[model samples]
Target: MRQSRFEQAFLAYLCTMDVLITVVSWLASYFISSLAWSLDFYPQQGETPPFWWCLRTVPAVILVSLLSYRLSGLYQLGRRWPLWQEVFHVLKATGLMLLLLVATTFFARNPYESRLASVIFLALTSVGLVLGRRCWGIYFRLRRRWGLVDSKALIVGTGRLAKNLDVALRSNNWMAMEPMGFIDDGVHSSVGRATQTVGGIEDLPKLVEEHGINCVFVALPLSRYAATKKILRLLRDTLVEVRLIPDVPALTPLAVQIGELEGLPTLNLRSSPYSFLDGLLKRTVDVVFASLGLVVISPLMGLIALIVKLSDGGPIFYGQERMGLDGRKFLMLKFRSMRVNAETESGPVWASQGDQRRTRFGAFLRETSLDELPQLFNVLRGDMSLVGPRPERPYFINNFRESIPKYMLRHSVKAGITGWAQVNGWRGNTSLRKRIQYDLYYITNWSIWFDFRILFMTVRAMWDKHAY
Candidate 1:
C-alpha cells in the first residue's frame, strides 16, 4: 500500500508524544519544589525517577510507537486526505497495547500495583499525540498542494492527449502538479490544441521562460522521432525536468496501475486484479472471515464428517487434489459427495442432476453447502480463501487455459469456496468468458466491502437456480 501524509503525520505525532511525555515528566520532576507538596501523592525529596528510567522508557516508548506505526499504516505515504483512518489505526493499536500492558503490569505485581498513572498516561497521551500530528500533517499537505506553492509541469505534445492531461491538472483539487500548456514541434493541429500551443518546437526556450514550466513531458508520437530528438537537444540549455511519453506503445494497453515501475513506462502490457491497496484489503478480509468461519463452524463440521461416514460405512472425507493459486496443487477436502466407488465408472465428470454417482446424503449436502464446510479447514490450511476464483479441475483448467485470453490470471491468488461468480449467478455450467470476467472483476475491485457483499449475496442465493 502507498504511504500517505496522514500516516507520516501520525508517526511524527507518535514521536512527539514520546518526547513530550519524557521531557514533561523529567522537567516536572526536576523543577517541582518539594516545599509545595504533601505526602498524599508527592514523591519524597530526592525520590525522583532515576535518569536511567527516562533513558530506557522513553526510547522504549518511541520504539513501541514506531512498531504501532507500521501496523496502523501511519508510515504509508500517499496523497489523499487520511481523515479518521489514522485515528482508527492509533486507537486499534493503543487498545491492543493497553490490554497487553495491563496484563503485563498485573503479572508484575500480585494485587496492588501502579495503574492510576497507566490509565491517565494511555488516555491523554495517546489521544493528544495522535490528534496533534493529524492536524499538523493535514495543514502541511494542504500548504504544499492547494496553496500557490506547487510543482510546475509542461506537456511537450499537443492534441487530445495533451488536452486531457491539461484538464486533469486543472481539475485536480490537490495542488500538486500545475500543468503549463503544450510545447509543439510544429505549428500544426498539435500547437492549436495545447492551451494555445506555446509556440512551435523551436519556441521551447520562450515557452519555459514565459509560463515558468519546471517539468517537461515529451508526449510525442513514434513518427516524431526527429522532432523529439531536436526538442531534447533544445532542452539541454534549460534546467527543466524531462519526461518522454512514447505515443504508440504507451497509449496502447494503458491506464494507471499500481506497482507499475515508473522508468519502464513504455512497456506496460499486463493486467493485475486491483492495483495495490485493494488487493491487500481483499486478502485481509479473506483471512479474517475464513478464520472466523473455521473457528465457529468447527463442531458442525465434525458432525458432517460423522454423518458422511455413517451413511455408507465409507470414508467421511474426500481429498481431491486441485490446481490452485499460481498453479500449486492442494488436496481440496469435502464431506464425501459420492459413493465410495462413484468415480470408478466415468471418472471425475461434473455431477449432473439425479446423478447415480452421488449418494442420497451427498445430494443434500451439496445443495445445502454442508459439503463445503471442510473447505473452512482448507482456508485455515492456506490452500484457499473465503472468496475468490473457484479452482477448477486440472482437466478443465488445462482445457480452458488454451481458449481463455488470460485464464491463468485467475490463479494469481488463492481459490475460494464462494466467489463473485457464484454470487452473480455465473456458477454451474456458465460461459467461461463471463465467469472469467467476473473472476477478473473480483481480482480488480476486491475490497472488504465487496467481499462482505459477495458473502451476503452468497448466503441469500444458497438455493439459487444455478446451484445444481
Candidate 2:
C-alpha cells in the first residue's frame, strides 16, 4: 500500500528529532564533564579540551546516530509494536552509535578524545531517546483517542470476519482507525445498529465519496473470491488504501505472518515462541534469577523442610512427574505439603479448598505457597521457566487434553512455578476453560516485560483464596 502524506511527515519529524537529540546529548555530555575532572581520556591530554573543539564531532555524531537507528530497523518499526520493543530498539541503536563514535575517534587521530565523555553521552542519549519516544507515543495515543488523526475505514463484507474486525477496531484505538460503516449485501445484520450497512458493493464508491473514507478493509471469505475480485476491481479508481484480511477460520488461533519462500509468498501456520535470541534471553533470566532465588531463600527452605519433617516424619520434599515443553515429562520438585499417603486411596485427585490430608502446618505451607519454593531448582536446571503456563501431572493432562481442544498448545513453552493463569486467580480448579484462555493469552503475547508483569502480580496475589 502507498504511504499516506501524514505518515511521511511523521517519519520526517522523528528523524529530525533524532538528529537534534544526538547533537544536544553531545553538548550536555561536554558540559557535565566540564564540572567534573578534565575531559582527557586519551594519551594526549590537556585540561578539558578547548570548549570550541567539542563542536567538531557534531557532524559525525548525527550521521552515526541516524545510521545506527536505520541499521537497527527502528525506522521501519510501526507504532503497533509494544513499548518495550520500541525502547529496546532505541537502546540497541544508541549502543551501536556509541561504538561507531569511539571507532571514529580512534581512526581520526583527533587531539581531543574523552572516553568518559562518550560514556556520559551514551547514558544521556539513551534516556533522551526513550523519553522522546514515550512523549511521541503519548501524543499519538491522545490524538487517536480524540479523533484528531484517524482514517475513516469501511468494511467490504458483512460476515464473521467483518464483525470480528469491527469489534477489534472499536476496542483497540491504537490503530487510529475510525469505522465508517459496512458495505455488503443486505442479508446480514450482525454488525450491530451502530455501524449499519450503507449499501451493497455497487454503492461503495458513493459511500466512500459521501463519508470521505480513506481506507477499505476486505474480509470476504475464500469462497467469495469472485465477489472479492469484483470489489477490488471497482476500488481501482478510488484513492483509498485497500487491505485484504484473509478469512481463514481454521487458522484463527495462529497469527499470520507474511513471508517469502523460493520467490513466492508463504504463510506460516505453527511457529515456536522462542526464536534463538528469545531462548537465550529467557534462559539467561531463568538461570540468573533462579540461582539467586535459591541462594536467598535457602535458610527459609531449610526451616520449611524441618517443619514438614517434624509434622509427620515423612519425606521433606516430593518429586512428581509433570509434562513440560513439547510434552516432555520431568521430575518436578516441591516441598511436600500433604501427608505421605494423602493420595494413596484416591489415586490422583486435585487439592480442594479443604480436605482431611493436611497435618495443620501442611495447610499453612500450601496456603502461603511456601511449598512451591523447591521449583526454583527446576528453573535453574533448565526444565522450567520463571514465567509460563503451570505444568500438570500426566494423569490430569490426559483428561484435560480430551476435554480441551487447545490444551496441548501450552506445552510449546516450558512450564512455570507461577504463571499467568495462577496469578490471575484461575488456578485450583476454578475453571479449566478460563485457565486455558489466560495461558494461551500469555503464550501468544510472550515478552520479557510481560513476564515481569506476571511475576509482580504473583507477589501481590500470594495471599489469594484460590491457592489452597
lDDT top scorer: 2
**What tens digits encode model 2's per-residue C-alpha lDDT throughout 289-401?**
99999899999999999989998899999999999999999999988888898888988888888877776888898888888899999998888999999999999999999
Clashing pairs in 1: 3-76, 3-77, 3-78, 4-76, 4-77, 4-78, 7-74, 273-444
**Residue runs of model 2 more than 4 Å from their true location after superposition:** 1-9, 35-46, 51-53, 70-73, 76-96, 103-116, 119-153, 159-180, 187-196, 205-214, 221-226, 236-240, 247-250, 254-256
TM-score of each: 0.60, 0.82
Per-residue lDDT for 109 in model 2?
69
What lDDT, from 0 to 1, does candidate 2 have? Answer: 0.82
Tell me how many clashing residue pairs each candidate has. Answer: 8, 0
Q: Candidate 1's error at 207, in angstroms?
A: 3.0
lDDT of each: 0.66, 0.82
How well is each residue in 346-367 modelled by candidate 1, as lDDT tens digits?
9767776677887888988877
